[model samples]
Target: MPRVEFGMKTESGEEFTINGELTDDELLTITNFVQSAEKLLECRLVQCGNFLPKKITWNQVSGFDICEVNEIDFEALFACLHLSRPFILQKEPWSYNSVSGILGRVFSHHSEVKRELKGLRKIYSDGALSYYFDISIQEKSIFDESRFLSWLNSYQYHRDQDKSVLYDELKSSFSENGAHHIMLIRLHGKLQAIEQLTHLCKVIIKSSAKQS
Candidate 1:
């Protein structure tokens, strides 16, 4: 087992680390959580974010360092796992007039997602921290600046490919911190690639405590 170390901090400012090989179950739990978050991104849940809760509840699960924190900024927690810290957590709201207005425009074609949500079903995560976070949503994303910026890079690319999409006019969604997103994406990719490889190979992940 390759040694993995996590730097954890509590809401009250206590910090500690859990460094070791993860049990099979702990690795599986974290894997599932991440998958869910990725699915949300693919589904374009970022457009439906206004309905997301401002605050979410969290409880530590089977593993990781024993940090007695209640309100770890969901974004920051995962940012560490990605090998960097996000300087900003709060994002600019989407420019649509209302949540539904954008959701309708965005998902009008994907009637299946709407119908299924009405029917009650849970999606899988590619990176959902739900195992540790009770509820991380579109409004309060689990992505650090790197991940979000990476998504935006894709979005802008696709938008340029197809300008006729109804929800393509979401420019107002960027916060003042948006300027640094592109820089983060380019540099962060170097850090993230090695992490995925760690799943299948004996890779030593590097860590730094620069982030919250």
Candidate 2:
């Protein structure tokens, strides 16, 4: 798929650029940006240690992960996404707390990643992150099992008792504050498709206005 480059300028003379492959849902979101009376885009960066998947399909990611070793730069990612939209960057620990959160959501079969988003709303004073992305997707996530299995494999918790007890701990840790590697990206912006794709979606947003 062809990559699209996006550029924008703020009323205050700031300039920003981003290039990536968009998913179908993302394209739809961007299209909505163009039609809606709202011109602002709410964007946020989901950074991780590893390179993000080259091609992300719509609704493909079940949830995001961030272990202790893979801390993302919240400041940088937030700035990039904030430029294009009314953005929010949820801050939490990227440690055992994150692991436990994922596990808690799994054991309860709840997929919203509440554990991952500890202190999210209080920080923003904006009700919740759902104002950006559909929190409902979590209830029906496709990668829940995968995330759970990945956690199990990470610690090599093979013994039955160890696994059982760990599950309980995860549920308990759901309410604690800790670091999380994953972040959410919810954008409301215009979509000018530079190119379409059979495998992946690619588009661009450019500004003819000069920087101040």
Estimated TM-score for each candidate: 0.22, 0.21
What tens-digit string does per-residue lDDT give for candidate 1 at 31-90? 443343343333322323222223333345532122222332335423332322211112
Question: Model 2: how far is 77 from its true place, Å?
Answer: 1.7
* lDDT for residue 208 in candidate 2, whole number 0-100: 13
Could you tell me the C-alpha RMSD of candidate 2 in Å? 19.2
To one decimal, what is the Cα RMSD in angstroms of model 1 from the true structure? 19.4
- Flag clash pairs in model 2: 41-85, 41-188, 42-85, 42-188, 92-179, 93-178, 93-179, 93-180, 94-179
Off by over 4 Å in 1: 24-29, 52-212
Clashes in predicted model 2: 9
